[model samples]
Target: MSKHQLKAVYVISVAAELAGMHPQTLRIYERRGLVSPARTQGGNRRYSDDDIELLRRISELTDEGMNLEGIRRVMQLEDENVQLRRELEQAREIALHAIREAERAGARGGGGGDLVPLKQAVAVFGQRPSIFDRD
Candidate 1:
């Protein structure tokens, strides 16, 4: 989390103002499992910058004429897409490291058949583009 996100200092009213949303709308978002803010010992809601950003995203999705379920699914897929991209990048990095290590070992000892190039070693999950990314 960023510093701003870690600091859940905004009360519901302040967060609503920052996100350009109503306090009741924030409450509804929380109820629908879109945003989760922290609660104080006194049982007041405290929102982080992350929550405010999510509210803004929700607002954008709504403005685009998407239903709540469609917005939820789009957000879920976006999260999954981001995660998968991270995982794929990590895998590619690992594969590159292994290829370099094998090349070094081969240069030292004349054995090079054990390792494969990155394109051959790694498998992409899906190349299909998202509807949101379509023209």
Candidate 2:
């Protein structure tokens, strides 16, 4: 986890105040699997900035008339979407880097020996030409 993800300094009361929620509500949310705060050695819950933002998001979703289960599913999908976007970005970067390397190799008089050749073909979609209409 990153430093921001692990930094949990705010106690429950302070976290609730920051999130504009009651302490008990935070407990309820925790039980519902909405927000998970860190814990101290004494088993005291400690909220991170990420947790605070998540609480705020939960509040917003609650106000939007979504049930707890629906909110959980929505948050799960959103997390998946974020992960997919990150993977896509990484793939794009790798492809671009490969293309640049190929261009540099070609510019340096390399015969493109590292590359594989493929055949190309074209097709006319709508109607066959008269040249192909011979019976």
Tell me the lDDT of candidate 1.
0.84
In model 2, the runs with Cα more than 4 Å from the true position are 1-6, 113-135
Which regions of candidate 1 deviate over 4 angstroms? 1-6, 110-135
lDDT of 2 by residue, 7-124 (tens): 9999999999999999999999999989888887789999998999999998999999999999999999999999999999999999999989888888887884457765544557
**Steric clash pairs (candidate 2):** none
lDDT tens string, model 1, 57-122? 999999999988898999999999999999999999999998898888888885745655443233
Cα lDDT, all candidates: 0.84, 0.89
Model 2, position 105: C-alpha lDDT score: 86
Give the range where candidate 2 is weakest over 10 consecutive residues by summed lDDT: 126-135
Model 2 CA lDDT for position 33 = 89
